[model samples]
Target: MTMSVTPKKAIRVVVWGENRHEQINEVVRGIYPDGMHATIAGGITELLGDDVTVTTRVLDDPEHGMTEELLAETDVLLWWGHTAHEEVTDEVVDRIQKHVLEGMGIIVLHSGHHSKIFRRLMGTTCSLRWRNDGSDRELVWTVSPRHPIAEGVPQPLIIPGQEMYGELFDIPDPDELIFISSFTGGEVFRSGITYRRGYGKVFYFSPGDEVYPVYHHPGVQRVIANGVKWAYSERERESYLVTPMYLPGGFDRPVLGSPDGLVDYYTRELIEPRENAG
Candidate 1:
């Protein structure tokens, strides 16, 4: 008798948070006592359950908790940063970029749009207008109702309080625009967008501002969990270096033979001779 083997491993996710605000600000700490990374990771675990294995990483960790081995094992990485974007080293940014191109999925949350990895992948300023007096009401509308990231998301994700992030969001047009948000101040923003770079998938959802309790909102948590699930890569290969593929030859082109011998096969039926042949 033959026993069937499982087809795939559990989805691996790493939630990376700056953790600076919680360290310095009492209010932020009160909102996310275990740090935003932990809270985000917990939310993903709650939503995905046994299908996903979620872990937390922070800016203070060595190499910012993004060691080569860790990234190699991470199928999806969620990034959250606010105050310490510049403190992230160029070396780590390069590492993240390399892995992303290799097929790892990335979810850039809120202020992470300004992070180095996000900017490098986007090849743009990744800038946007914003305001946060802490009293703004945000209604995140599902623009693409059928998107995977919007599978269980509410029609208009209502957050009673959140930092207002308005547009002209400076970035390339997204492969998919999943959500648009409007604030009480009448400012609208593209709140959820998705992109593709090399073999990887990226999703940016702008709602988890550090100063507010946005991360704890059930709708926000569900959206983030859905984003993580949507961004997971299913490809077989996971290396950045791609080699050229060989295909059938025609016309003047000949199939490759031993390079040293440089032997050439000739036949009219196989490859028509040049019109100038004499």
Candidate 2:
């Protein structure tokens, strides 16, 4: 189903960046003087226009700028991180995970495959063979042309220079494969893919490296913008599996009394209380 956010109710997007590279590296600063998060958010705003309300957040912000209130209002979130994935606290990861399971969308970019949130969602190491040659060419080919994320993207999006990310990427099989990329060295990788965890949507695009001007590429920008739109959920927010949920669409049923047992939430079978209960 096509998810469209009207002008009256724009899709709320948050672009989260590590912001460490631009702060400490001159080369990275020259490419993204205002920080990569700003550039990414700007690209989405430029493409989606009023359809999306974009905001920028960074690792240095309090709670990584991902307060509960902020996440509650956000419909889709784009994540870009490297060098300081460990610095993102476990508490924040838990919050992000909970929100995602509750229906907020997320896009994990570039090296974010190794991030705690991604790894937790993927249930894998999220490892891959990589090289910082700085001159490797990347050809991003659309594998699933009919997918929404590939709407306006060309058959082959050519990137002149990029860090090589080879295959054998340690990740669970994605629900949908959107794009695959090949490096100059003949190594191919599943670059763009999507997954649904609980009520949330996820997209992982591997093209924007800090060392290169990949984010400035028009095609890459379009892909990210498209991803934001595609990731948004159209339905009203609904809580995930939790306690107090009754069976048969919350329908009430007869409760048969047992000597020392009660019906299970799922199996509807009688279970006895444990003797070692506190």
Candidate 3:
């Protein structure tokens, strides 16, 4: 028998930016006058169109613009933080972590590898070698062409100028490695990688440095949009993914907790049941 599936509505996306450099550095400001988060959000909208609904948030916003209500409505979140990772409070990081565990997708971009949320999920220092002389060229080689995040992405996509991120990246092995980037300095790095945390997906793409107009590159934009799409979780949002107790012959239903007494799997009843236990 064929099972019918419901069509998905538009993907809800939140692009979170540090918005620090643009406010202080002239070059970064020139590259992204409206803040990198806005540019990133625009790119997702431009590529996905009606398939996605994108919104921008920044570090300066109240609660860093990542309230519980906002995260509940967000299917996927894109984080771009650079100089202010610590400013992101532990409370907000805790919330984001919980949401991710509950099936909210996240795309951590560039310097966001050092962000609190990414590191918390990664359980590593998430450190890597890097240079920012603005003289390096980046060629993002698509190592996994068939990967969903590599869709429409050109082979060896070139960026005229970028900061170099070298290897020895300290993190757990990625679930998938989609792109490897080679810099002019003869350094190579895993530029595009993915991971799974509980029911949520994570994508880390290290191309868009704020000093360079990498976000304006069509190839990079396409890759980011594809990452957003691939990272989205179709499962209904949950408080968390919990281990449920199931009774034999009642496999269709799952009991979240057995507060009163132990459940008898064979008999499908409670052992030493409490007076008010249902």
Candidate 4:
């Protein structure tokens, strides 16, 4: 038997950030002068370069930095939000979910677990526990080592200092549970998860603490870049069926092809609230 391999496809990724932390937190500012999105996008550019096209978007921008046109062009969208998830309009969230359903990849980072789109897509409360004492040592455990999203991951990579997000993550089962995290204080979490929604892939990674320099970590950056490439799908899936045309005026129905309820004017395809409903 022969095995099959997929050809390399150029991934188009947009790293969307709220940009509030960089402005409000000196530590965050010191880590990413250009903003978290820029830092993350820089890593993607450095890692994938010609293999991927990375862009940055922020919440303050018009259309909240994600217009329908831009969403359509983006093969994968990376989200990082803190202190401003509420600022993201539901319209944009709807567009994002719709695009995801149409096969666009999505990578939700850190606090983005509570992002409107993430909650909507997952249909869960998307809540978690956390502590801001800055005593948490994030030891991210590598679970799905063979998954492309975990391609360059090192087991239990340590973030010496950061905010601890403890969890009984409220969400549905993911297609693949990639990386889990066990904090130094004895809290366990499903820190990374991958799922398929509609025709697209989705991943949630908990990192990039607002007060820590997580984006600078080589392992974290590698995972983000790999995730961008992994989540994207090459082909779009069409679900709606087109109805058949009516026969010419009064043409005699063929005996074998009688119009006896066999050929209807409309075809019934399962219609979801969102056209690209996953």
Candidate 5:
């Protein structure tokens, strides 16, 4: 007998960006007239349709595009940052981290690997060697050939003319590494990696080049769409493993406590600090 594969649930995504390059650089403006975040949201909207909702936000917004209220309502957040990573406020980062710990999915693109959320989740320096000459030809090798993220792609597909980001990227080992990038400049990068901190899943995909139309490519969009589906859980289940107080109220106490100890709500599992802030 064969079992049926369940249809994937739609993941709500927030297409977020620094939104500066479009205004400051003519090339970027020409490539994505509506802004990169809008373009990404367009791709996701086209792919997932009514099932998935795609919304856009920018750094210059009232809360730098990430507010506690907005994050509480977001399921997945796609971050695109280049020159304005430092401009993102610490408070916004905290809100995002809290949501992730509770079970949100995060996708970081290109230059966003250095963003605060990525660094905090990975718990590392999050540093990498890079070059912006814009001549690098990246061969995106789908190493985990059997992984869900590579489900429909040909192995070692090429995305010409990308920025080179070289490792040893100072990040905690990813829970899974979906793709590796080989550049024309003879540099190799662990370009696509995934990690889970608390109940959330995080993915980092490196394809968009600052001056190139990489994001507009259909293949890139398909891969990211696939990733979003892969990152979603079978059902959005609560993260906590087990708790004593969860037992039915007014239960008569066992005469000898049937092997289980008394429950203490005040004494609970401590979460790892979302940031290494002093």
Candidate 6:
């Protein structure tokens, strides 16, 4: 029963950042001189090496550096936005949503929970209790130790300083809960969770804060890299899922129809009828 499978090409990743903090705040600039997106991309490249091609994008870039052409080529997109979440146009959010549903994987990091793309997909407020006065220690516990995203990650990944994100996390329950984080203030949050939207996979990891050097932590970087890999979809890219009809006794080829035609298109039962069925 052993079947040989063809290997896929290297995973293509794009790290999208707000880039506002590094530009305006000296402390953030000092921590991540090249912007957090670059750091995140660098970590993915460092970990995945030849297995992945990583690129950095920012909100300030034209079309927020998420052009249709670029997204078409991207296999997995890592988003990190904070102050400029509202600044992201609805058009871009719609574009991202379309791609995500079409099988492009997305990894939302930290404050990205509030981003339009995340909210649109989640259909909720995506809110949570948080503290940003620094001085918060986070212990990310691997709730799902056997999960692929938790592979090689420490049992209790310790982040010395980070912003607290506590529960009352206003979103649907995750398909998979990988990591749960406990902060110094005796609050716990579902730090790492995954969801499936159409043909795409979504992972949200809350850790990296602009003020703290959380991204610099090796464990944190490893988790993010692992999340990127796990989020990547192996299916052939499609514009969107479609219901293609098949003729009676014909299963291999679909009965394709023109987009302009409505009456010609038919919806058939997805499951073939059993010959023994009355």
Q: For all the candidates, what are their Cα RMSDs to the real structure?
A: 6.6, 6.5, 4.1, 8.3, 8.3, 5.7
Query: Using Cα atoms with residue i matched to residue i, what is each candidate's TM-score against the true structure?
Result: 0.87, 0.87, 0.90, 0.82, 0.82, 0.88
Q: Write the per-residue lDDT of candidate 2 for residues 1-278, one digit (tens) a residue.
A: 99997647899999999999999999999999999999999899999998988998999999999999999999999999989999999999999988999899999999999999999999999999998877699999999998989989977999999988988999999999999999878899999999999999999999989979889998999999999988899876665655433435537632223354444544556643434211
**lDDT of candidate 3 over 1-278, digit per residue (tens):** 99999876999999999999999999999989999988889988999999999998989899999999999999999999988999999999999999999899999999999999999999999999999997899999999999988988888899999999999999999999999999988999999999999889999999989989999899999999999889887788765555667667868765543677655543446664666544
lDDT per residue for candidate 5 within 40-146, as digits (tens), equals 88888887787788789999999887887887677888899988788888888888887887788888898888898788777877898888786778888987888
Q: Encode model 4's per-residue lDDT on 1-278: one tens digit a residue.
A: 99999867678889999998889888778888999899899999999888888889899999988998998888999999878889899999988888888789899999999999999989999898887787778889998788888886888778787677787788898889998888878888888898888878899999878778899899999889888888878785333223243345725432121223333322333222333332
> Which candidate, 3 or 4, has the higher TM-score?
3
Write model 1 residue lDDT over 226-247, tens digit each, in one string: 9988889877435555432233
lDDT of the candidates, in the order given: 0.87, 0.89, 0.90, 0.82, 0.78, 0.90
Quote the lDDT for 179 in model 6.
96
Q: Which lDDT tens digits does candidate 6 get at residues 76-168?
A: 999999998999999999999999999999999999999999999999999999997878999999999999999999989999899999999
- Candidate 1 stretches greater than 4 Å from native: 1-8, 242-278
TM-score-best of 1 and 5: 1
Q: Candidate 3, 236: how far from true, in Å?
A: 0.4
| Candidate topping TM-score | 3
Error of 6 at 146 (Å): 0.6
Q: Lowest-lDDT window of 10 residues in candidate 2?
A: 253-262
Which stretches in model 2 have alpha-carbon errors above 4 Å?
Answer: 1-7, 247-278
Clashes of 1: 0
Q: Assess the local accuracy of residue 178 in candidate 2 as a C-alpha lDDT between 0 and 100.
A: 91
Clashes of 3: 0
The predicted structure with the larger TM-score, 2 or 5, is 2
Model 4 spans with C-alpha error above 4 angstroms = 1-9, 237-278
